[model samples]
Target: MAASARIFSSANFNSHVKNVRFQLPCRNRQRLHLRSRQRVSKLSLGSPNQRFLSLTSFANFSPAQFSVSGGCLDRIFFGTKENSCNWNFAPTRISDGPHGGLFDDEKGPEVTVVVLGWLGSKPKHLRRYVEMYNSKGIHAVTFVASVTDVLWFDLGKKLEERIENLAQELAEWLSNSSNGRDRFLMFHTFSNTGWLAYGSILVNLRDRKDLMEKIKGCVVDSGGDPNLDPKVWAAGFTTALLKKNSSAIYPSPDKSTGPQSGNMENGLKTEPKETFSIEPWMLSTFEKLFSYLLNLPFAKEKLLRIVSCLSTDQPHCPQLYLYSSGDKVIPFQAIESFMEQQRRAGKEVWCFNFGPSPHVDHYRTFPDVYTSKLDSFLKKCLSSVASPMPS
Candidate 1:
C-alpha cells in the first residue's frame, strides 16, 4: 500500500513541489481522483506499504472539490507539456532501470503492440511481454493502470485523453514513414484492468476511422468479461494486494488438453481448493463492499456503459483471447461467453484455454505454449491487415 500518485497534469507541478507528502489513515485507504480542467493531479492517499487498498473513506467526498498539494506527488509523473499523462505509477524499475530501453529494438514494419498491465500491476510486471514483442522485431508501448483506475467511473476521462494522445503519436509516426511500409497497431491486455484500458483507447479512437482501421487485433490474457461482476472485482483486488498469497487455486495443468481442443462448454474442471493465505471472510467482505459501490445508480450505469462499448464499439479486427480454468480472478466462462458473443456478431475471434495457469500468469507458467499461440495469432492478424478482406 504505497502512496502512488496518479498525475493528470503536465510537468509544471514538478518544478513547484518537492518532497511534500501526505498520509491517509491506515483504515481509510481511498483512491481519490482530483481533476481540474486547467491544472490538477489526482493522488492516492494511503500508507507507505499499502497497495491495492480500498475506497471506503470517501463515500461523501467529491472528486471535483477535493484538492491536494505535494512534491513527492510530482516525483511520480514524467509528462511533456503537450500530453496530459502517459504512464501510471512510475516505477523506478521501468522509468530508470534496464527496462528503460523498452521500445529500443524495433524490428520491421510489422505491428506495434501496446501492452497494458492489470490493476495494481507495475511496469516491471509487463517487462517480459514487452521483451517478447521486442525480440520478435515488433515495437511495444507498455502502460500500467493503478488501482484507482478500475474502481471509479468518471476518473477515466484524463486517462482516455492520455491514451488518445498516444494513439495520435503512433499514427503520426506511421504517416511520416518514408518507406510507405504498411504498419498496424495491436493491443495486448493482461486482465480486466488492461482490457478496460484498451476499451478507453477505442473510445477515443472511435471517431478516427483511419486509425481505427489500422488496428489489427487485441490479445486478451486472463480477462475479457463483458459485464462487471462484484465477485470478480473482489477477487481481482484480493489477488493484486496479496500477490501469490491470495486465494488463487493453482491446479496442475492438464497437458492432455491443448488450448484449441479444450472442452469449451465447461468452466472449471475440478473444484478449486481454498487457500488460507487470504481468509474467506476477507474476500466475502470485499465482495459485499464492491457490490454496493458498483451497484450505485450512477456508478452502475457508467461502468456498464464502458463495458458494453467494448463489446459493440471496437475496431473491426481479429481478437485473440488467452485464458485458463485455474484463474481465480476472472472466470473462464465469462471469457468464453464473450468470445462466443463476438463470433456470433461476425467478428473474427480466437481463443486458447491454458488449463491450469494462474490469472495473468499463463506466460510465466507455460512460456513455450503461450508464445506459440501468441505468435501464431499475431502472424495471422498481420497477414490479414496486409491483405484486408474486400469490404
Candidate 2:
C-alpha cells in the first residue's frame, strides 16, 4: 500500500488539504447563498488495494496523520442533497509515472475519477483506491448521497426538493464550468448510492453536450440490491430497529421495508435462516412500498426511465461492476443478473467476486484483489482516453 516514498510534515504531514463547503443559506425567504472554497489537498489513496477490503486490520489506522503532497482541482462537487454529505478532491502528481512526475499537464489524459456512494463517504475510508489511482495520475472525486442520513425523516415535498436539488446542483455544476464536463474521463464508484445519484444525473446530462462528453466509462462497486439481502437488511435494520434511523435510501412505501426491498429470506442461496430473526410482517411491508412505488406514474415513467442509466440496455459505454460473493447485502444472483443482462446487450462488463465479505464491505472484504482489478480498469480507461482515436 505504501509503495511511494515516506515523508511526513507538520502541516498536513506533507499533504495539501482542502475542505469544500456549499451551503444554500436563506438570508431571505426568497433568496439563497451559495459559496465554494478550495483548500490545498487532503489525504492520498492510502493502501492502494487494501483500503476498501473490509477487514479489522485497518480499524486502528489513521490516514489524517499521513502527509499528502498534491493540489486540488479547479472544480465543483455536489454533495448528498440532504446536507449531510462530504466531497473531497485530492490531486497529486506521481513522482515516478509515465510523465516523469505528476500529471498536471495537458499531455496527460484529462482524467477525473469520481467515487459515488453514501454521504458519510470519507477519503480516509477509500485511501488506497484513491491513492493508487492518483499515483497513476488520474484525478479522484469522492462523493456520497446522504440517503441513510434522511431515511428516518418523514417524507414530503421538502424531501423531494432536497433530493432533486442535489441532483440539479451536480448537473448545473457540470454544465456551467469550462471543460467542466469534458474534463472528466472515467468514474470509480462503491455501493448503491453512486448509481442512485449518477443514474439520475445521466438523464439530465442528455441535454448538456459538454457534460455528456466528459463521462466515458463507469465502475460500479457494491451496486447490487439495497432492499434485497438480509445481512444488509440487518445492518440497515439495526439502524431502524435500534437507532430509529429511517434506513430508506430511495422513496419507498413500507415503513418496515428498511431498504433492500425486503429480501432477508434469500442471501447467497445457501445461508441459513435459522438464525434469521426476520418476521413475516417485514416482507408484507416491503411489498406494500415496492408495489406502490413501482405502480406510481412518476416512478413508472419518470423514475424508472431516469434510473435506467445503470441499465444494461443503455448505450454500450465501457462499464465494470465488482461485486462480492459473500456480500451479505446483495444476493449474488442480483448482481449476476445485472452483469449478464449487460453482457447480452453487447456492453463491456468486468466482474470479480470477493470471497464472503460483509454486506457492501469492499475494502476489508476484498482489498488487494479488487484494487488490482481496478488498477487494470484504470489503465484501460486511460489508454482509451489518452491514446489517439481513429476517425
TM-score of predicted structure 2: 0.57
Error of 2 at 225 (Å): 4.5
lDDT tens digits by residue: candidate 1, 1-391: 4553432223443332222222432232222222322334545456544423222223232334423233222212221122222222112122233222222222335467888887667667777887676655466777665544454333345455455555566666555667666677888998997897788777767777888888888999999997668788888776665555565645445433544433233332343465453345446655765655676566677667668778898788889999987777888889999999999888999888887766887776677677767877776787654432122
Error in Å for residue 45 of model 2: 39
Instruction: Report lDDT per candidate.
Output: 0.62, 0.45
**What is the alpha-carbon lDDT of model 1 when measured against the actual structure?**
0.62
State how far residue 294 of model 2 sits from its true place (Å): 5.3
* Model 2 spans > 4 angstroms off: 1-87, 97-107, 119-128, 147-182, 225-302, 312-315, 387-391
Per-model TM against the reference: 0.68, 0.57
Tell me, by lDDT, which candidate is best.
1
Model 2 CA lDDT for position 221: 76
- The backbone clash count of each candidate, in order, is 4, 29
Residue-level lDDT of model 2, residues 90-142, one tens digit each, is 35444664222234444454566666654345445566666666665566655
